[model samples]
Target: MGAFLLAWDPGGALAARIGVVNVQQVLTQSVAGKEATQNLEKEKVRLQGLLRGKKEELDKFAKEAQNLQLEIEQKGAIWREEERTRKTTDLRRRQRDLAREQDEMKRLLEESQRDLTERQRQAVTQIVKELRDIVHQLGRDDKFDLILDSTASGVLFATPSSNITEKVLQLYDRKKKK
Candidate 1:
C-alpha cells in the first residue's frame, strides 16, 4: 500500500475526468430532431388518410357486388337465362375490380411506409452527425478527458454531477439555431 501510494501519479489521475451524456435526451430535445419527428408524423397522417379513402372505396364496391349477388339468387328462378348470365358476369367483373384495387392499395401503403422509414433514417443520421460534432466541440472546450454516451455505453451508474446531457443539449440547440 505504501509503495503503491508513492508510485501513484496524481497528475494523471487528476487529468482524466469522465463525463456522461444521455444521447436519447439530446436527440429528442434538439430542435432539429423535433422538426424531423413532426415531419414524419405529418406524413404518417397523410398516408393514413389516403389508405382510409381507398378502403372506403373498396367497401362501396364490395357492397354493390353483394347486392347484385343477392338479387340474382332471389330472382334467378323467374329471370331469363341471358339476364342471369349477364348479372353473374357483372358480379365477377366487380369482384375482379375489387381485387385489383385492393392490391394497388396494399402496394401504395408499403411504398409509403418504406419512404417514411427512409426519410426517418436520413433525418436521424443527419442529427447524429451534428450531435457528434457538438459533443466533440464540447469535449475540447470543456477539457473533458472522456465523454461517454450513458444511453449506449452501458454505464450502470454515474453521479448527476458528472452528467453533461443538459449542457450538450443547450449547445446543440444553440448550434442548430445558428
Candidate 2:
C-alpha cells in the first residue's frame, strides 16, 4: 500500500497539458467566417430581389385580370350570348395561365432558397475544416497534449490563462492573409 501511494502522482506532474478553446468565438471572429457571412448575405439579397420582382409581376397579372373581368361584366348585358361566352372563356384561360406562372415563381423561390442553404452549409464546412487545421497546428507548435472545445465540452469554468481561442484566431487570420 505504501509503494502504491508513493508511485501515484496525485499532483499531476506527469499529466497531459490541457488547452481550452472557444470554438464559437474563433468561428465568428476569423476572417474566413466574416467572408462566408458576407457571401451568404449577398446571396440572400439577390434572392430577395428576384422574389420581389416575381411578386410584382404576379400582382400586375392579377390587376390585369381584374380589369378584364370588370370590363366583361359591364359589357356582357349588351353583347350576344356567343360573345359573352367567348369573353368568359378567355378570362378563365388567362386565370389558369396566371396560376401556372405563380406556381412556377414559387418553385423558383424554393429552389433558390435550397441552393442558398446548401452553399452556406458548404462555406461553413470549409471554415470548420480550416479551423481544425489551425487548431491542430497550434497544438503541435505549442506542445499541447490535449485541446478541448470549451463550448462542446460543457466547460462551465476555466481560467483565462488556459484559453487559447484568441491565439487560434490570430493564427487562422494570419494564414488566411497569406
Candidate 3:
C-alpha cells in the first residue's frame, strides 16, 4: 500500500499489487517453528546442566589442590628437605593437571555450544525456506507483483489489506500437518 508507490507511473498505468508478510510472526506462530524452538530450548537446558556439573567437579578439584598447597605452606618448616621437595613437586603437578583439565573442559563446552548453535541455525534456515516457498506460491496464485517481508526494513508500512501473513500461516500450518 503506502509502503511504496507507483511513482514511476504518474498516469496510473502500472498498478502493482504488492503483498507483505510478517516473517517473524510466522516463525513464532507456526507449529513447526514452535516445535523447533522447544526442541532447541531443551537441548540448551541440557547443555547448561552438563556444563554446570563439569564446573562443579573442576571447582572441587581446585579446592582440594588449594587445601594441599596451604597444608604444605604451614608445615614446610618442620618437614624434611626431601618431603618438602616432594610436596612442592606434587603441588606443581597438580597445578598443571588443573590447568589442563580446565582447558579440556572449556574446549569441550565450546564445541558443544557451537554444535547446538549450528543445529538451531540450520533448523531456522530450513523453516525460512519453507515459508519463502509458500510466499512465492501465494504470489503466483494471487498475481502479486511483489511480496516483501514486513519484518524487513524494505517495508516500513503496509496496509492490513495487503498483508498475507495470516493466509501464509494457515497454508504453512496445513502443509506441516501432513
Candidate 4:
C-alpha cells in the first residue's frame, strides 16, 4: 500500500493518525448492547408464551373433536336417522372450526415472528448508525485522521495504541446513559 501510494505521488506520504475499532467486540461487550439483547430475549419469551397458549387451545379443541368422533362411532348405530345426521353434522362443523382456528393461529404466529425479526434488525441498524457517528466524533476529538472498523475492514494488523474499541464502548455507554 505504501509502495502504491509512493508510486502515485512523487512527494513522500505525510504522517496521519489512524485508529481501529473491533466493532463486533464493542457491540457484544457494551452496556447498551447487553440491554438490547436482554430486551429482545424477554420479548421472544413473551411471544413464545403466547404461541404456546394458542397451541394449547388448539390441542384442547382437537381433543374435544376426537372425543365427539368416538362418541358418534360408539353410539351412532343405535340412534334414529335424524339424530345420527345431526351428530354427524356437528362433528363436521367442529372439524371445520378447528381447521379454521389452526389457520388463524398459524397466520398470527408468522406475523408476530416477522415483526420481531424486523424490530431486531431495526434496533441493530440504529445502534450501528449511532456507533458510526460516535466513531467519527471520537476520531475528530482525538485527532485521528482515519478510523477503521476492524470487523468490516480488511485490516489485518494494528498496534495496541491504535486500537480504540474500549474507549468507543465507554463513550457509547456514557452517551446512552444520558
Which candidate has the top score in TM-score? 3
- List, residue by residue over 1-178, the lDDT tens digit for candidate 4: 9886765644545667899999988778888788878888899999999999999999999999999999999999999999999999999999999999999999989998898899888878888899999999998899998999998999999999999999999999999999
TM-score of each model, paired residue for residue: 0.88, 0.87, 0.90, 0.85
What lDDT does the true structure give each of the candidates?
A: 0.91, 0.89, 0.91, 0.91
Off by over 4 Å in 2: 1-8
Please give the RMSD to the true structure for each candidate, in Å: 3.7, 3.7, 3.2, 2.7
For model 4, what is the alpha-carbon lDDT of residue 142? 94
Model 3 regions more than 4 Å off: 1-13
Clashing pairs in 4: none
Shift in Å, residue 66, candidate 1:
1.2
Q: Which candidate do you rate higher for TM-score, 2 or 4?
A: 2
The TM-score measured for candidate 3 stands at 0.90
The local lDDT score (0 to 100) that residue 13 gets in candidate 2 is 73
lDDT of 1 by residue, 84-109 (tens): 99999999999999899989999999
- Winner on lDDT between 1 and 2 is 1
| Reference-based TM-score, model 2 | 0.87
